[model samples]
Target: MTVASAVPRLLIVAVSARRQDRRARLSQEIAGMIERLGGAFLKAGQLLATRVDLVGAELAAALGRLHDDVKPMSTRQALLTVTTAFETVPAGIEAAVWTPPVASGSIACVYRACHDGTDVALKVRRPDVARRFAADIAIVAFLTRAAAKLPMLRRVPLVEIADQVGMSLAAQLDFSREVEHLRRLRTDLADLPDIVVPAVLDELSSGGVIAMEYVHGLDRAAADKLPAETKEAGLSRLVGAVYHMLFVDGFIHVDLHQGNVYFRADGTVVILDAGFMFRLSDMARTRFTQFFAGMIRGDGEFCADILLSTVRHVEKGADVSAFRRDVTDLVARSTGAVAKDFELAAFSVELFDLQRRNRLFAESEFVFPLLCLLSLEGAVRRLHPLMDFQLEAAPHVMHGLLLTDAAVT
Candidate 1:
């Protein structure tokens, strides 16, 4: 190639490398800052961990540490936040005995306490967190919009991702919403006895503080310490519940990492932190349910059609025919494959990549479903590597399909 023509390619490669390097530096900076800031910044860092498409893998990995490593606000601040949230001395909070925080995150700190003769957990939003989040998100929104115009970044919904994530973060400050999310999830998943969502104690809850049933359980690694059957059954139930939320109800618990949810001693799964959730559009719900069911049925063409339907915009001159063919082949290859070997998370990631490669930008709702799939995949893989995901998912997947059919009919 002539030097003049080669310059454009060279420039593109250099820009890509520069962007990658910048993301790396930013991720490292963010991780350190969250550790020190201990408020809304920490919450945003944890939220960013689920957004691999916009933040990229390196940044998300760095932010992942915030889930467990977030520092609690000072003891004085914790108590003051609780007091402020309640607008007075909350019930069961004697000035003499306020337990140190049992858990802490960007938006809130959790303490174990007694309320009205019952043991409970108190979740108090950090003082000034809402102000901090509002200011920071404005910066994030601006940056994402600027980044979205870049050739490499244009394939992702950078602005929408930032906006969706910002709104989710903001929602975390409202303990009332978290309370409602808990109650609704409990009601919806009541049929799944093996799954547990702690009961909300409404009497002690306010806009910034919530009191709920206290749950004692092993952390996520509990699977390693449990019986194989227990682990498998718990994970299977978890997947089924997530499918129902994502496809049927379109209400998703977006922040369901290891720290936020875990397994109890009896193998009942415990989900926590309803601060960041996703409510999908009517169209997204129908299409996502159909697409997921298609995958379970080993129908790639069907999956591809649904995938195409879900996306909001596609670049002109993109070879959509070739995209469909590639997806068809991807689906065809998975047919009759060993269930343990299917690796749904990896396949889903690849499918998303295929969309990116074809210049298809989807709505923000899509990201959470992908993250949810990966989380479920990790939970199952750790407990039972040899277990068949397809066989396990088939029942729930079929239920979603039936629901979708009924909705249409």
Candidate 2:
């Protein structure tokens, strides 16, 4: 069935599953439907998997399988795509030596190969994937616009969110831009020795194909079984690197799903797939930093003010005072809580709930950073449960705030 037809079925299923007990089964059913649809729908599932605040933890976990479990193109199909993209087979790489894909996703499948005596990972875009995504995005835009007409969703900025998703999907189609993202991230995280961003082979890469250094490392589950000290230090480095990206540099890798993050035996973190990324404006970055700084200090009013300043729209006759009070109370309750005690997913869900209740809509750009953090929180908690998130973020927040103040001066 087409997306337009499938959406109504989805809505019907949602309506039928109103009872709390059926939500888990409902989530699985919806995930299965999306998986069968494939293409942009599968990509959307992968993103929703990270958004526990919006969909709840159970549903998010159900959809998370879309990250790397999609069916891959056949070996011949994959080879043909690479050959077509290059106009001919690139030298030093033979088709016969190419093994089956090591990983597969909505847009591409990754194969392991050797180039110039160095092991490399070859990422080839699926045939007609771009055209399919374009068609799906158009349909999604129409659906979102229609959904926005409902009274309950009028303040949600559905159309804008759809546009952002479309832009990100389109960017991912261009392998060349991902190359730039990989290089920039490598430079940005250079100060952190434990972080690894693989090197891209420009000569072998193109708009549709990317060749990069092949990295072998343990997945999150395997890494969790490592020594306690090693795991702790690695988790610290990973979180610190993420903080550096958010606070020190405005650029961020928005997709930090389980499939993209790996850990070496020695505790080095390997970040793969630079397809989905965004750069925050200086103002947004500073505001985000200030907000976190306030959270660290247990200053609820300050945090509320920071949030208010970044809102894109405030509904007429909205209760701004009540919103402020709610935010204040939320921060107070979360004060001094560690990763184990304070769930970012739960906190974000409450915060977004408050925004919806108050008809306060934050700028999408500002909100995406929080979503990125939410995406990483699962790994953070799994690796180091007792981690003091606010405390860890304090230094980066202070540095970001100071840098912004100096720039103003």
Candidate 3:
């Protein structure tokens, strides 16, 4: 009788321990829930990671590392999704069929299949992804407006942030638009066969459904095994393509990290994810050009003036001086390293943690610029670990900055 009683108590303790473990995992769960909440949080996280000016450094770093990982539902759920979306089973219309996805992300899942004797990838957006985003956007917009009215948030300008978020999220939800964006990118880079954009089959594509040619390649980890020359060539292609996109084309891939980039067997670069591209406005471009030039020229004052003008400052009760100091320190650290042979190109999480503790910016306004800089940084690191950035990016940045001055003149 006592043993029986002890068994029940032990079971109770086990359940209690499980609950405690779950409670301890609450933070991770919240991060996941933030993503599942969709629209606002994902958009916000992306923006925050980019905006070293708004969300603080540590959070931005954390946000930057956040992936679009999602839990995949069953095949039955996928079938229901297709049936609800297009009023028919998508598998029937295609020349080939795909099983449920091998991988899933926040917005969509990718399935490998053969269609019309040609291999293709079937990308299906989660059924609730759109609806969830729509609802979240509304809530975010409302909150942004409310936040903007608050004295502390006026400088943050949540309303404007919301507008950017709303527009960006809306664009992401439209698969057709993504197809066109990819097509444009492909056309622009037609001369370069070292990169390939998957072709979207229009007949098989709908509002949230896209069928495209599958390009197989090695992820970053596997690519490390390749010969040094091939690796160099691959890195060159990736960097060159990105440089063209940002400096020459003026269209930026908002996300350009390793996972979004893949290496083919022939040493080509394959870019994925079309949902977060950014096209700079003329004025914004000019301002950024000036900023880049200022950095290239090592003109701190000029850069400061441009930054002050470019960023929306709080009307009052904010530490503008501290903000300036933070920016200066960041510039010094990041650029100073460019000139040093032994300096690491990578931005460590600790740097972000320090910045956050110091109360630096929090939003994603700076993501694109940082991305551009880091893309080059990453490329150089991959190709010539001993490279002097002054030799490579400075001239281009200087040249680009002159455009800003010319516009002002």
TM-scores across all candidates? 0.81, 0.86, 0.67
Off by over 4 Å in 2: 1-32, 47-65, 92-98, 218-220, 313-315
Order of the predicted models by TM-score, top scorer first:
2, 1, 3
TM-score winner among the candidates?
Answer: 2
Candidate 2 achieves a global lDDT of 0.81
Question: Listing every candidate in turn, what is its Cα RMSD in Å to the true structure after a full C-alpha superposition?
Answer: 7.8, 4.1, 8.3
For all candidates, the clash counts are 0, 0, 15
lDDT of 2 by residue, 1-409 (tens): 5656777777777778767757887788778788777778887688677556567888977887778767787777776777776766676444522666778788898877777677788888888788888988888889899998998788777788779878887888888889999999989988788899888888888757888888886464556587988878877888888888899898988888877887777879888899888889898899889888889999999999998998977878888999999999999999889777887868877887788789897666766787688787866666687899889988888888888989999
Better of 1 and 3 by TM-score: 1
Mind giving the per-residue lDDT tens digits that candidate 3 earns over 1-409?
A: 2223445544554455566564334334334545555554655455444443344444444554344345565565565555555655455433222365645666777777665676667777777677777877787788678776865444453566567747777787788788887778777666665887777777667756677778776454545677878876776676566655655456777666544667766878887777767776765665665665565566656665666676443444455576566556655655544322423323433333333333333334544545555544543554445545543455445555565566579
Candidate 1: tens digits of C-alpha lDDT, residues 294-313: 76688888988888877777
Candidate 1 residue pairs in clash (backbone atoms < 3 Å) = none
Worst 10 residues of 3 by lDDT: 339-348
